[model samples]
Target: MSTAGIGLGLTGFGVFFSFLGIILFFDKGLLAIGNILFISGVIMTIGIKSSLQFFMKPSNFKGTISFGIGFFFVIIGWPVIGMAAEAYGSLILFSGFWPTLSVFVQKTPVIGWVFQQPFIRSFLGYRGKRAPV
Candidate 1:
């Protein structure tokens, strides 16, 4: 699939899990499942970024390891740490100003780059032989 396709899929997963989590709040077991799925979504995006980074720069061990650690943390923390982390982030942007700014920034190309900086241009290995640099 194309990069945009992968990114959009990840985004959909994140949204689905988050919404499910909200809907399941009243039911303890379902809530836990939703939380786990949410964590999985986060891990999925991190893995995609890491893979892309690997393709871009084979020697970028730091970036690879960073994503690996994030993946591990999200997996290990699912239903607890993951849920709390999401909650914290949501709370942080709960303000009217922050959400508005976030939307505005996302709409601006430069600002969007700022948000995607960590993963932007990171490579997903090409299907065939590597091209000459």
Candidate 2:
């Protein structure tokens, strides 16, 4: 299976667990499982750009940062912020997927506006731009 395929599959698992987490909020174990899967799915979907084609160089940097923040928040038992952080982190990570997504979906919606920033551009791995020297 392709990376995109794997990423999407993980995304499904993540969503499932996230709903499970919500339903079983009082149960720490199930909640933890849900939280972990959601974060993992987002990160994997982001494709860890730096690792892609070692010679190509990654244009993004903050995916790991947001991901860490989310992970930490979850560890500290802050369910709300942790999930929010994870969500933002995943969106941060999704920059790379934007170009391909654009081809399929046409409008990028709100993220289309956020995509204007230089930082967000990097996060998207500089999709459509020439490689740096």
Candidate 3:
């Protein structure tokens, strides 16, 4: 399999483990593992150079710093706070991709139906805007 495919699997697992850790009363070990896997997966998927460039961009500084801080907090056993920080950082860092994600979700068979609902669409502020790739 290709590196990107492997990376995607790892990323999926990382997200799963992270959520599982949260569900299991904020387990520190699980969160740490999840964080490590997630970062490595991203690097592998995008390549080191692109990953560095993406993270080091001036516009992404705040998100990068926040994410770094969150990772540090997780390492120090502050799982709850670390997760909270990471969530905020993720939102900021990935805001640009939200439109693309929305489009994808809307195109899916099952999820699309739910996403098309008036209440859900309004809540998510999804006005069917197509993002430029």
Candidate 4:
């Protein structure tokens, strides 16, 4: 299999392990393992140079810093707080992909039906736009 495919599998496992860690009372070891796996998987998926460039982009500095600090905290045995910071950093870092994700969700077959529900649609739809006067 290709490196990207292997990386994707690793990423999936990393996410699974992270969730498992959360479920198991925020076990630091599991969380740390998950973080390592996730980071390595990302590097493998995108290659070293591109991953460095992506993280070093000026617009991504804040997320990168927060993520780095959170990783440090996790290493230092502060799993909960570190995960919180990491979550925020992830949100900031990945916010740009939400639109693409939404599109994908809408296009999928079974999952798309759930998101197409009226209530779900309303929740996902735009709000608070004013008409031209």
Writing each residue's lDDT as its tens digit, candidate 1 over 27-68 gives: 334444444554455446557566455334645444444434
Question: In model 4, where do residues sit more than 4 Å from their true spots?
Answer: 126-133
Q: What 10-residue stretch in candidate 2 is worst by lDDT?
A: 50-59
Report RMSD for candidate 2.
8.4
* lDDT of each residue in 76-117, candidate 3, tens digit only: 999989999999889889898997887788789998888778
Q: Pick the candidate with the highest TM-score.
A: 3
lDDT top scorer: 3
Q: Which is superior by TM-score, 1 or 2?
A: 2
How well does model 1 score by local distance difference test?
A: 0.48
- lDDT pick, better of 1 and 2: 2
**Candidate 2: misplaced stretches above 4 Å?**
1-8, 22-31, 38-59, 105-133
Ten-residue region with minimum lDDT total, candidate 4:
124-133
Q: lDDT of model 1 at residue 26?
A: 33
Question: Could you tell which candidate, 2 or 3, scores higher by TM-score?
Answer: 3
lDDT (0-100) at residue 1 of candidate 3?
A: 98
